[model samples]
Structure formats: C-alpha cells, structure tokens
Target: MSQDERPALEDLLGAKHRWYHVVDLAPGVTTPGWIDLRPHVGGPQLPASLQGQRALDVGTFDGFWAFELERRGAEVIGIDVDQIPPPDTPQSRWAEVQAELDGAVPGTGFELLRRWFGSSAERRSVNVYELTPEAVGGPVDLVFIGAMLLHLRDPVRALEQARAVLRPGGRLVLFEPIDRKLSKRSEPLARLMIGSTIWTWWYANRACLTDWVKAAGFTDVEDLGTRDVVDSTGNKQRHLTLHARA
Candidate 1:
C-alpha cells in the first residue's frame, strides 16, 4: 500500500472493536490496545530471539506477543476461545457477565492486525483446556501465556494443558497479575476476586503463582520478578513473570 492510501491509526482506533494488546502495525501507526506490552518485547520475560523455534501463544488477543515471537523468527500459533467464559463466581453473576461479553467477537482484532503485519503466524480457536499436540498441529518448542491465568476457573489445569503441547524440555514463559499486598508475605497466598466485573477469578501472590507452575509439572522454575504497567485506560497494574521448563 502507498503512503497516501494508508489508513490513519486514529481511524483504526476509533473502530467499534476492542483491542487487548498494543501492536505496531506500521511506522508510527500503532493500535490503541488495552495493554501495551511493547516495552517487554526483548526483555527477560520473553526470549530475545526465537530463531528456529516453534511457539504457542495462549489467549493471543490482538496477536502482540505472537507477532513479536514471529518477528524473533519463531513459527507461531496463537489460540483463543470463540466465547469468553464467565468468572468462577455465583450462578447469579453468570447472566451479568455473559451480558457484558455478548456481541463481542473474539479474534477480530487479531485477524486485522495479522493481515496488516503480513504475519504468517496462525490463529486457532482453541480453549486453553483443550490444548494438545493434536489440537494445535504438533508440539511446540515454547509456550507463552500472558495475563490469562487470572481469568481461568482452573488455572493449574490450564497450565497442565499448556505443558501438554510442548516438546520435552521445552520452555514455558508466563506473565500474570499479582496481588501486591499478598506478595509481601513469604508464603503462597491468593486473593479471591470472584466478584470482579471483568471476570478476573484470582489475584495470586508470586509464591502462589510459582507453586502453580511447579504443580503443573514444570521444572527449573524461575521467578523473573514484577513490573508495573499502565493499561490504555490509564490503570496501573503490577504483574509477575516466570520462566520454566517442561
């Protein structure tokens, strides 16, 4: 496309669809995403280069991390469910949560950005619980899950499913929300956020998150520490990052 024919970033941002990850579609033309992960691209949270690797991105909203992995030379496949699941709360809250998610199509922004970036990375409609070698073509060398565990009713099971699709001794990198107050304690702890309107189920401490990884059968677990990031809405959130081997 010629410069004169290029779509304005502001016009794309004004569209009805919601984008979850900030992505640079072109020079100075970036998507207005809820979470801007551009800063952490080459950081310790992710491999500096995924040259000659096969990677799976769980909950790949808007394809930011998946595209980054592809940019680093990995053959990437991103997976997400067609419908958003309700939080692990009372039955009374299901209607309200479902109502909020109604009419919101999953993977629309991802498909749009994928086409814009000319990315060969594939996007699949697969739930985290259904992840497997057969489900995602074959085992991958690395599995990346970002900011997704908190929304799962069974995070540990999801982790195990993530593990199932990795080659033996493959890498597992995860980014998740952490409870600042709970993290101050040395013991494993988690705060139940069943009442969250956004469908967040748990806000676990770093230790608790580490334990969950270990319990999922990952080895060489390493907590890479925490960092604060601002969402598109200007809300500050602290997140914990971990790396492990399957």
Candidate 2:
C-alpha cells in the first residue's frame, strides 16, 4: 500500500486530532512498557477530558500511542531525544509494530524521529525542558507515557514534569512496564526488529503505582485497567493504562 493510502493512528480511533509520537532509545530487545497492550479500542475508562484537547506524547516509540491519542481528539506534539535507530541499527518502530504477527512489533508503524537517547547530554533542545500550564498554551489534557517511563532512571521526576505540563484537571495516561527478570539473555530477533531490547522499568505493583501517583501530588488517581499487547507467539507483556490528575 502507498503511504498516502495508509491510515494515521488517529483515524483508526475515529477522531481528527493532531498526533505526535516520541522514542528516545536504541533498538529494543523486548517491547518497552515491558508489558502487553490490548487492542486499540476506546472505553469509558478514557480520560473524560481527552475529547477535543491537546496531548503530549512523551517517550513515544514510533508515535503509536501518540497517533492513538490523536484519534481520540487531542492535538498532539510529539517529542523525543532521538528519532532514528542507534548508530547500531537501521530499523524503526513504525515498521516493527507489524512484526507482531511474527511475535515482534514491526518497525514501520513506530518510526518517527531521528536522534539517540543519550545524545541529550552533549546536545540538548530548548523544547526538552520547556513547558507552559495546559490551560495556557494548550496544556496537555492528557500525556501518554508508553514504554518511556521504564527507561527513565528517575521516573518520579519525569512524572512530576508531566504533571507540570498538564492543567490542574489534566490526566497522565501511563502504560508503565514494571521490571522483569527475563529468562532469555535476550530475544535477539525481537530486539533487532522492534528495538525493545535495551528496555527496563521498576516492575511496580498496581498498589505501588497508585501510591506513586499520589506521591507525585495528583489529587485523584484511578486505574484504567491493564492492557496486554500480545504477539504472534502468545507471549505478552503486561501493562496498565493509568489515569491520574494534576
């Protein structure tokens, strides 16, 4: 199919919002969020404010969730330290998402930017730490934290930043991947293809995350149900889509 004929991530969700996807890491071994993602379907569990609002896709891996959020009717601004594969590989998440049928997230649908994760150190972008309250410059009604949280050594700080980006009533949508002790040294093919290889997270329990949201100073925190993105092989990573207010 031609690129023009392809549907944008938001189109699939039945909306006309702008979409953004960000990924700041190298090729991954396992899908980050280190968990499974359910089929992209909407439900009442979604943030009530998602309709006709703005969203910031942090740590987007090929804009998957970013596009999904756009379809939900939120203007999206995608941000990432790196968009291209690490100097080590020449693949992207956009294409890898399709690899799911092969038990890997194909790279086509997930590819978006062209920078590396650590590159932020030597060179930084003004937009990196830039933010205005959601109510002011279109404060994000919701922020999607796909697999991005795991890679962050200090996820709490990131969460705080996300809170700052949102308005008082805005929500942070998270698909956090708790840490795991995989038996295999690595899933070579999946790593090479989806770039989920070098991923990590704290492997927090539901209760732990609930507490975390509160600790981050969010007034109301609720579970939006966990999602499992299953691959062709039947192996799945477990993840929860959380809804927390600023």
Candidate 3:
C-alpha cells in the first residue's frame, strides 16, 4: 500500500490500539517505543515529548526521534531526505532506526510526514540552509536538530528559521560531537581520515558554537561537552549535548 493508505506507524505500535506488539533490534540499533524512549534519547523525557504537543525534527534521517516522541503521545511530524544509498551507506542508518523502534514499541501513535527543510520541501532530503520554519507550519513547541548544525554553511540563519517557527517558550535540543581542544591525536585524524584537515562537522569548538547559538536568538545556551566519549576506533573524543530555549 502507498504511504497515504497505510495506517500511521505510531498507531500500529501503540498499546492502546489493537495489534500491539513490540519489535526487537540488535546492537547499534536503538529505535525506542512509547514504553520509554527518554532515558536513552535525551530530550524524549522532557515535557515536550508528549501527545497533542507538536515537534519539528530537522534532518531526521529515519524518524527515530520522531517515533519516540509520538509514542509518548506527542503529535510528532518528521521530515527527511528519503533517498539513502545502500542499507549500509550513511542513509541506511534510519532504516535501522525505524526497525529498532518497531521492535521496541510496536503500536505507537505518531505521524510521519516525508519532507525536507527548504521552503518547498517535498518527500525527500532538504537543504537546511534553505529550509524555513514558516513552510513547515510554524510555532512548534520543540525543534530537534541532531548531528546537523555543524554541517550548515550558515548555522546562524538556520537557527533563525527555527526561532521563526518556535513559540515564545519553545526549546531547541542540539546533539553533536565536538573536537578536542588539547588533543594531539584529533588533528591528524581530521587531516587524513576525515579529509580537508581540521574542523569538520564531526567536531566543533565551544567558541564557535556559542557564537552561532547565541546569534540565533537562543537564550541560556549551555555547551555540555565537558567530557569524552568512546568512538568506533576505541578512542575518546569530545562530544556535546546542548539545550537552549527560544
């Protein structure tokens, strides 16, 4: 059946609805259902993740966070670029994402709208730089931008778009990895494996982030990359989880 004809994925996974059954996933795949998505996903536990409340997820690859919010009873809408290469490519991450969610919470009550970030976003990927909050139906309660801000050529403008759609007390949760300030190993990897040398999206400095988030009109900005997290290469890198109110 076409996407329009199929029942909403969240509803199918909801316990209150019929045909309730939680799907299971393996390691590295974490798609959580309504039973509880907050502890693991960060913002899912906040007041914003609920039913009737509205949330806009920018650069949502496979609707992972969207589904989690939906399961919590929030009226969630997710937009992403629908064209991912192979299941193993960067695009396939969400396939695993949905699968894991389906495994965790089978009958969630959420809605997924396939679109992008631009003024004329369709059922595909979006150019975040060109995407506006007005086009997505503004004044949403919360806006989630995960692992997407650093890629922006102009992140400040993007935050402006977010502010345009956000309510007076709305919040923005940014999850990204930052580069190590005093680490000697990080510099070489950026040059060789990461390409182009230092300062890729995989990493950012505090000053740069503060300047951008503040410029975007976000108040009480906090950069929480005070520690290190282990990467696939068995090394620890500086990472951040920031929350700011608009």
Task: Compare the candidates by lDDT and give the number of the best one.
Answer: 1
Better of 1 and 3 by TM-score: 1
TM-scores for all candidates: the values are 0.90, 0.56, 0.58
Return the TM-score for candidate 2, rounded to 2 decimals: 0.56
State the lDDT of candidate 1 residue by residue for 6-39, as single tens digits: 3455555676787777777667867778788788
Alpha-carbon RMSD of each model: 3.3, 12.2, 9.8
The number of the candidate with the highest TM-score is: 1
| lDDT leaderboard ranking | 1, 3, 2
Residue 110 of candidate 2: its Cα lDDT?
41
The 10-residue segment of model 3 with minimum total lDDT is 114-123
For model 1, give the 10-residue run with minimal summed lDDT: 1-10
Q: Which stretches of candidate 3 lie over 4 Å from their true place?
A: 4-40, 43-45, 81-125, 182-202, 224-237
